[model samples]
Target: MDAWEPRPVPSVTPETEPFWSAAADGRLLVRECPDCGLVYHYPSALCPDCFADAEWREASGAGTVYSFAVQRHLGYWPEDDLPVVFAYVELKEGPRMVTNVVGCRPEDVEVGIPVEARFVPTDEGGIGVPVFVPTEP
Candidate 1:
């Protein structure tokens, strides 16, 4: 089998460009509805809840693991990165993202573990990808 290459670089659209820009500057941003005060990811034109116009807001970068899975093998990635823990983290402000849990072992993760966001440069385009790591009490 062929070895894993780098993931595809994300193309920035008008709506998502702000997110990528903020991430490059080491900030995590989420779109928030002014009417309902609901924050969400994957930037959209209208609010998911009230359909009101939303604005970008800085996130606190702190969350708790909602769920996770330890990937022991990859068909398209490098084996050296085995045991990658993929998690759904519920942000303190009110959004959940499917992000990788890094800087720790997969065996150590739990459903409610506290995590803090971190940005890492992507292999494809040097774009900042938001990841999470275990938070120290």
Candidate 2:
């Protein structure tokens, strides 16, 4: 069996380019809509609520764990490490994201646990992806 290796590169696409760019630069982004005052994640150009074009801006990086589940299988990405905790982190700005819970044990994750976005630098010490971890009070 091969040892699980963590991601050493950042993944950015047109739709989520802003987010990745910001995270790489030590900032967290949350979607905000000028059309209807709605904020969301897994960013969309159009507001999910008002269907208006949205904008990405820096977030407080402060949120709470709303829900979570421990993933035991890789499905397609078989190289994914086991006991991966998938969580819904609800930001104080009124948006939530489906992301992984890092910096702790999967079995220790709990609902309503405070969390914040923490960047994982790439192989060459460049900015990488944003992962969540338990936040301190």
Candidate 3:
């Protein structure tokens, strides 16, 4: 088995600095268009819906698993970290974002399962990466 490599840290740009800064504090943020009222992720300068400048808003950190895939083998991941669950989580605010489902076994995840956001700090202590875990019953 190969050594575990650290996950890539997201690059911070002028437009995304606030988003990353908030993430470092364990807060999840989404971009909202003041014009069209569209809320979305992957912070960008302009809204995809109306091209209007988007503003940052804190999210509720609650969501549901929309779809997922269990990876049993990936060259970059350590052997012990097998079966990573990658999923698309639909935030209660109404936008879908790609994220990972953690804190549980891969087989334990399924579509439509309620989830909540959890932040994992980067190895270098940079911005926290937002991931989801199943909500308690």
Candidate 4:
């Protein structure tokens, strides 16, 4: 395998810090609105629906593939030397997240496929990025 670097780490802001920290510990966290009980992604300080303060909650870490595409080539992802499955996963709790599907062939992925979250090390020190993999039937 070619010795290549991973993608640059994302800058964590105050609002997104908890999500990234939870992911590093092998858990996935999402924002939940205490007022309306709405779950959402891209963790924010306020709910998008009702403009209420959102609380951090642990997610089920299980989701379904809402949509997906395979990237056969990319400059930054040279370490894998294979097609990368980019997908939008709909979490069981409600919100959808943009993540990558791993631990299976790109051809095997499909819409509505069951997947569970996996944490992979990032270029960012002390951080693990969340990805999804196929779940058993």
Q: List the global CA lDDT of all models.
A: 0.82, 0.76, 0.84, 0.86
Task: List TM-score per model, in order.
Answer: 0.88, 0.80, 0.90, 0.92
Query: Across residues 27-82, which tens digit of lDDT does each residue of candidate 4 receive?
Result: 99999999999989988989999999999999999999999999998887754556
Best by the lDDT measure:
4
- State residue 71's C-alpha deviation in candidate 3, in Å: 0.8
lDDT of 2 by residue, 1-137 (tens): 12213533545568877777677677888888998898888777889888998988789988899999988876643454666888888988878888888778887799998998887555533344677889776
Residue 1 C-alpha lDDT in model 4? 15
Sort by TM-score, best first.
4, 3, 1, 2
Question: Per-residue lDDT for 1-137 in model 3, tens only?
Answer: 11113655777888888877777688999999999999998899799988999889999999999999999988876567788999999999988999889889998999999999887776544467788889975
lDDT of 1: 0.82
Candidates by lDDT, descending order: 4, 3, 1, 2
Stretches of candidate 1 exceeding 4 Å from the true structure: 1-5, 123-126
lDDT of 4 at 110: 94
- Model 2 residue pairs with clashes: none
Query: lDDT by residue for model 1 over 16-40, one digit each (tens)?
Result: 8888777767799999999998889
